[model samples]
Target: MDASEINAITDWLIDGARSAPMPSQMMAQACERMVAAGLPLWRVGVFIRTLHPEIFGRNFIWRQGAPEVEVGTVDFEIQETPEFKRSPLSLVFNRGLEVRGNPDNLADVERFPFLLDLRQEGATDYVAMPLRFLDDTVHAMTLTTKQPGGFSDAQVAALRALTKPLTRITEIITLRRTATTLLDTYVGNRAGERIMGGQIRRGHTDTMQAVIWLSDLRGFTALSDRLPAETVVEILNHYFDCQVASIRAHGGEVLKFMGDGLLAVFPIDEYIGDANHVCARVLEAARESRCSVDALAFPIGEAIERFRFGVALHVGNILYGNIGGGNRLDFTCIGPAVNLAARLEKIAGRMGRTVVASEGFVRACGADWNELGEFPIAGFSTAQRVYGLADEAPVVMA
Candidate 1:
């Protein structure tokens, strides 16, 4: 490609591609533009490291003639594998260096096993370059060519010239994605969306009806007193995982984890039909969590110790939004409904019940419930009715 063509592509990268909605789309368009400009591009790949709990990075692959780019995620565990260590992408990621391979060179093909496949596919040359972000972090991009004698020196130079513009665009996209992932990880998805949508000011709240979930690990104080700190933490993590996985799978979002206690909500939307379905889903989640907690066992010295927890579900209106002092704020929910759920959870521990629901929940869920009778709840003037799962027997604490 000539200097003019390269300049056009750089302009597109800065102006058009930078505003693309997704990284994958940007990559595909970039490659398409390069190929259209008479660059001998056969396949293009962009790899960018990101901040996430489970994902290490993401890769966007655009093969010539394909309608769309193939996007894939690399997990943290993959970095420890022998395959990743031996791959060219790893060298670019770890060493911050450019890698070049010729399909005709046996040593290059052997050193990078991926080259062998490229050679078989009629590829003649491959080049991987470092994409240095504003923070000096190194990412990578690879280009392959099937042209007769591979990319010319001029073509390679033009591609090199484009890296600076590409790096700026990629960093812009990566930073936005990182911000979103961090928010989603720290808060629930729905809350994260609200924060991103500018609902970040203190006292910014919206009243909404939801099925509230409050749970506490039974006998946690005594267990922590007996077990080592690390052991206690490990057990708490495993125990919370049991509930979190089930809750998320059943359309609930975990709002907070306080010591061995957890709070979550399943939002109710009038537009989405009746509250019965949402209540039923919360019940299913509670049942699954109960079974998981029952099967949970941890090794303590020579014997295994079983675990138990109490959950209280209530359906009512909650004030959902940000509330805190100064710059430090917490995006969560509050209301009388939350207070009642908390009280019901404490009552569950005293009653040795695994799961309990408020009268509102029991009525909405339409489930066969064992009426547990009215009991005086703290901070409330009247006694509140509670119900337990008809099929669940009171847990026998060891």
Candidate 2:
């Protein structure tokens, strides 16, 4: 590779990096250009650390003649296994050193088993370089060739010359992916997009009618206190799985989790049926929640019955967006109906009901529910009416 070839690859990479929406696409183009420049690159792999709740990192692999990049994710357990310890990527990440191994050629050192496997597959050279970020943490950039002579000094120098631009391109891609992963992990997808679209102002809110869904374990405090700390966490996660799966399956976005409680919303947009579709979604979610929670019992016979929980659904206008103080904020709903939903859940057990809702929700759902009489609620100037969304017979209480 000469100076002209290197310059052309750098220019093409700089231009393509800006237009590519995905990191894999940018990498694919770069690999194709490198191979075109007479660099016998048979396979290329890059790994990046990201800010996702469940994902530790991801690997993007490009092979000759493949249309695009193939991706593999690194999870928590994968990071701890012995398989990662003996790999070139692990050495680069852990020791911040460059590694070159060629098992096919005589007199060349081959340390890891993976390199030997690559040799058997016709690879003549394997080189892994440490990709550093602004924070100084090392990721990975690797290359392999199947040519008989392997990579010449000129080819390696050309790759070394592209590091600055490579770092910039990958930095942009990783940061973009980090922003989306963090936002989607913390906030629901739609709400996260709204926030990302410049809705971070403290007073920024939209008044929209949505069905509010709030639910919590019936005896979470007692359950947590009576059980081991580890058991408590397991129980909480199990309980959340039951609610979250149901809500997401019904097109509801889980907005927040307050210890034992979960808050969600099914926003009703411009399109409206005779009865709002959001109501049925919330009802369907509630039914699924009730059934699933029933099955989330302790594996043992420690308790006479399964764990219990209650859900409250109400439809009304809400001020949804950023709200808080001291430079921190919460992107959540706030309105009279929000208060009413929580208060309804507070009395659900006393009323011998597992699921309850307001008249507005009942009307929108087009369900025959027993109406609960009006009652004075805290933080409210007047009494509020309610209705039952329970599967059982009516059991109204004060």
Candidate 3:
């Protein structure tokens, strides 16, 4: 690109980044730019549903003003990668490489279905830009031209620069939306059979067996009141990041974050692995996460604040799935089990404990527990036996 063209493109990029629209809106703006620049079509997809990076990475094509590829559909496709061929965007998504040009000449595209679809749809020219942060490859951006040969070198370079900043904005938007989605689902009790993200078993009732996990930040509401909005957001986001990493690493699905708390579940059935193993792993992860939080308080040159968390786990049958009317639906868990989990969380707070599980859950865990005696939880009539997973360390709320 010449200096003038480079400057113009950079200006456009900064404007686009500054606008910071929703994903759908971002795609719309992207397509508008491509069309204005004389390209025929444009696409932006993130490969999240597919565990295997090689399949269709999160892919979307914006033609004209419509959102041809919606987020839900993209997530489904990612989760449903077949046993045979993986999606084409997998190359750029998993391998950290930018793919450009037509598949007939780009050997990698010769075997990809998404490319074939684009080709069928009259997208002859293509360019895929991989966004990499540090060593791990997060996602990719693909731009298309309907002309027979795909994008030109100049066009590809222009699109690449345009999308680099735009891609980070997209990632941030994705994470925020994902967090919001989980929160809505759990809070509304709409998450059903697919509670923990494994495939829905054919013929199985939409019902699911789950280990409901509720985690709350001690004094979060107060902290929010005392701290600046930006500071509050940063602290909660960092805390949530730690919790989410721990939950996913231990094979649990984080359902939501309600103000200062989190809801997660271990759908043993969906996990397909040993339920006990998964539970043990998640507990270990929780301890590690707590330790991580503690370590963060003293590491840097600046003084750091410490935070405490309360966690409660309950295993029972709960209704799960999408809930709501029209466009406001949520994917979340429902039923007495969810309520009981939350109640248990409250009990944990009263007892000044970090983690607690019911007697039934403790028995299922097959681990020795230090009993906290029968306690009358506010919402329940009978006193329930709660136990701390104190096989090693004592439980303290915070």
Candidate 4:
């Protein structure tokens, strides 16, 4: 690209970054502008590592005349895959290398196995540019050419010059996305928005009435001791699948995942539902989650056939917001109701029940709950009444 064309592209990208364009659109626009500037650009791709649990990274592909950029994702298992080990992206993403390949040279075969196939597909030269972020993390951008003579030294120099603004534009886009991901990953969506919306002062809280739910794996301590670490993690994830999906389906927001335990709440708002409606929502989720946990099938030789979980439901006024010390902070709920919900989980397991509801929940829900008799919770001075749900829940709980 010439000096004037480079300036124009940089201005366009910097302006686009301000408007919060998609990552793929930024890459595609850069490719379009570079080709307009007399650069023999055939394809461009970007590989950026992100902070998602399942997605290891994302890829943005820009071809000559595609309507929009074709996108793909790399799963967490990418490092162990043969496809990752064989590609030029692997060298850049793993070894932090800046790779250039010319298909005309047979010597490139040992270095890039993809060179042979790309050569047949009309690719003459390939260059991978490594972009370094302020955090010291390296990402890659691959640009390919179909020209006969490949890229001249001057053209490669110009391409290198453009990498700076290109990196800035991508980092701008990535930073926005990473913030949302980190918030969503560490905190619930509702709480994450409060944080991003500038409600970050310590002790910023909201008092509300909601149905609280707490679930715990029955034998996690013993299971962790008996199984390998990896096996234990997998089992925990499987168990969570049952709890999270059911809770979300019934309009419950998952608040936290405390080791083998899960905490969630169904907010009772005027527009969403009344107090009785909220209770029924938690009961339905409890029934579905219990069935889901029981249906988990393991291999014949596995330690256990299926996971056993105890779920407890309670309802009362609770304070939901940021709570912690100077160093560490957590956005969660805390109150006497929250403590009672946890205590009921232990009582459920001891009584051989998969689901248990406190008097507050059962009464507010107006559902027919079989009384499990009064039990003395550790912290409470007097005994409290606890109830369990039947196998089949009626159509209407209220």
Candidate 5:
């Protein structure tokens, strides 16, 4: 490719490709543009590091004449694997080194076991370049060709020149993704979307009817007092995992993890379903959490001990939005409904029941429940009627 053609591709990266909706689409178009500019490109891959709880990074793969790019994620554990250690991507990611070789050559194939697979697929040239961001964080991009001889010296130089513009584009995409992932990880998904959509002002709350859920570990104080700090954290994580998985599976968003307690909600959306539907799902989540906690066992030296938790469910309107001091604000829900849920959770612990609910929740659920009688709540003036699952027998706590 000539100097003008390379410059055109660079311009496209800065202007056109930067606007692509996703990294996969950007990579596919970039590869197609490089091929159109007379570069012998059969396959292209771009690897970008990301900030996520589970995923370490993402890889976008583009093959010639393919309909769409193939995207995959790498976990943090991959860094410890022998395959990653021997791969060219590791060098590009860690040492910011450029790797160029003939995949068909025995020496190169021996050095990189993956090259042998490419050689079998008729790949001749392979080049991996480090895409150094402005912050000096190194990402990776690789180009492979099936052409007989491989990329020419001028073509390699052109590809290297394109990296500067490509790095900027990649950095933009990565930063956006990191921001989104971090928000979603810290706050719930719905809250994250609202914040991203510019609903960040304090006291900006929306009133919505939802099935409010509050749960707490029954003996967390005693357990934490006996166990090490790290052990307590591990146990808490395991306990929350059981509830979080079930809640999310049943269309609920966990908002906060306060010590040994958790707060979540199942919004009653007109488009999704009615109050009854949402209440039923919350009941399912509650039952699943109960069973999971019952089965959870922890070992303390010589013996294994089981743990339990209490959940309180109620259906009412809640204020969901940002609320806090000047600079640091918390995106969460608050109202009398949440307070009642908190009170009901304490009642569940006192009553030796695993799960308890308010009258509104039981009515919406339309399930067989045993009325646990009216009890005076701390904040409320009138006594509230609570109920428990009819089939769930009360456990004897030591």
Candidate 6:
């Protein structure tokens, strides 16, 4: 290719890198270009194993090409420059050429059984390539063929040329998703605007007034004991889905699912509304939680008590940013206020109330609440005047 033509192709790739949401699609387009530019090829595939080993796990069909194989294949290692041994039945894992001249070895084919059937089916060639973008450790692309002879050396070179740009694009999309998920976990609300701010500085912090709600599934342990493992997971997922949807639908963020319960919050942004507004939003979430729970008719396989939820909402300043050590960090909030919310939620269970809030929350709401009385709550240094948010008259407990 001439310098001008190569420059045009490079520009097109750069533009694609900017627009594409994933590396796989971008690699497919690049491979199409390589094919158009005289590389004989029909299929293109990408594999990323950074977070999940299953991306290139054993018996993979994209590489091994055995139709009879159930699971795909994995590559523990790769050999360079040798003509790839193509098999009609072998599963290919690497990114390169699998051709007729590439002699197949029994021991190698045995290691990846997905390739066994491909050889039996009269398929002979494959090529898989590994692409690394930025600082990532497990991202690569693979190209394959069912024909007798695999792609030529020049074709492999063309495929290699597209690797860097493809990797770079993949890295960006992956990082962005990581950041967004972190923001959602900590902010406890839609943080599109807040996450946008994170792009400005690497480790800046912000304190926002937010209404935090913590709720746990009651009798979860006893319920789990009675049901089979599959039944347990199904029930938990169904319950969590219902609870989380109620929270998210009312502009609340489900921060973390703590096995049996969830933590959530509605950010009281000055630009959005006020504390009372945020509490009402949380209260709406509470009502929705009850409604959703009541609607569930899940069978526990025994005469188990119906599921119920306990919620506590508190509004205060929570310092939000990333925490933890090294690269393994979490973007979440911390402070006395978060602790208080959790404390009250626990109190709800002991006091036989579904929803409980501190006197401070009630004062912030500037509304009357059913008097549940001042009591010494565990983990709190002093007696806290708590209130019960019931559907009817307050039912006080000892």
Residue pairs with backbone overlap in model 2:
none
Residue 260's lDDT within candidate 1 is 97
Cα RMSD, each candidate: 1.3, 3.2, 15.5, 4.9, 1.4, 9.5
Candidate 4: list runs displaced more than 4 Å.
12-16, 219-238, 248-251, 274-284, 296-306, 315-317, 358-386, 392-398
Error of 1 at 354 (Å): 0.8
Question: Which model scores highest in lDDT?
Answer: 1
Which 10 consecutive positions of candidate 2 have the poorest summed lDDT? 389-398
Off by over 4 Å in 1: 16-19
Q: After aligning candidate 1 to the native by TM-score, how far in Å is the CA of 370 from where it should be?
A: 0.6
Ranking by lDDT: 1, 5, 4, 2, 3, 6
Candidate 2, 1-398: lDDT as tens digits: 55777788788667656656677888887888788777789999898877776788899999999877999998867778777877877889889898888866454533577776787788888889988888898888999998887889888888877766887778877887788777877888777888879999889899887889988887788777777888778788888999998898888899999988999988887555424677877788888888998787665345543677888888888889999996798888999989899998886766767888877788779876887678788998987787875456544432
Residue pairs whose backbone atoms clash in candidate 1: none
Query: Which ten residues in a row are the worst by lDDT in model 5?
Result: 16-25
- TM-scores vs. true structure, each candidate: 0.97, 0.88, 0.50, 0.80, 0.97, 0.56
Worst 10 residues of 4 by lDDT: 389-398
lDDT of each: 0.91, 0.81, 0.65, 0.84, 0.91, 0.62
Error of 5 at 143 (Å): 0.6
Taking the tens digit of each residue's C-alpha lDDT, what string does model 1 give over 150-252?
9899889889989989999889889988988888888988999999899999989999999999999999999999989999999998999999999999899
Where model 2 places Cα greater than 4 Å from the true spot, the runs are: 11-16, 105-110, 228-231, 272-275, 299-305, 372-385, 393-398
- Writing each residue's lDDT as its tens digit, candidate 3 over 56-170 gives 3344555554635465444335435651235545667557677655655556455564666666676677666776633354576666666556666666666667666666666
Question: TM-score of model 1 relative to the true fold?
Answer: 0.97
Give the lDDT of residue 281 in candidate 1: 96
For 1-398, candidate 6 gives per-residue lDDT tens digits of 23344445566676754444444445445554555555555445554443322222222122232232123334533223133234321223233323232325476565544455556655454455555555535454545555556555655666567666666665676576556554554454444445556523435557888888888877788777877888878888878877788778877777677778787767887776677777776777787887787677775446553567678878888876666665665556677889888888887887778878887678777554686888776677898888886454433432
Query: After best superposition, candidate 1 residue 40: deviation in angstroms?
Result: 1.3
Off by over 4 Å in 3: 1-205, 270-274, 298-302, 391-398
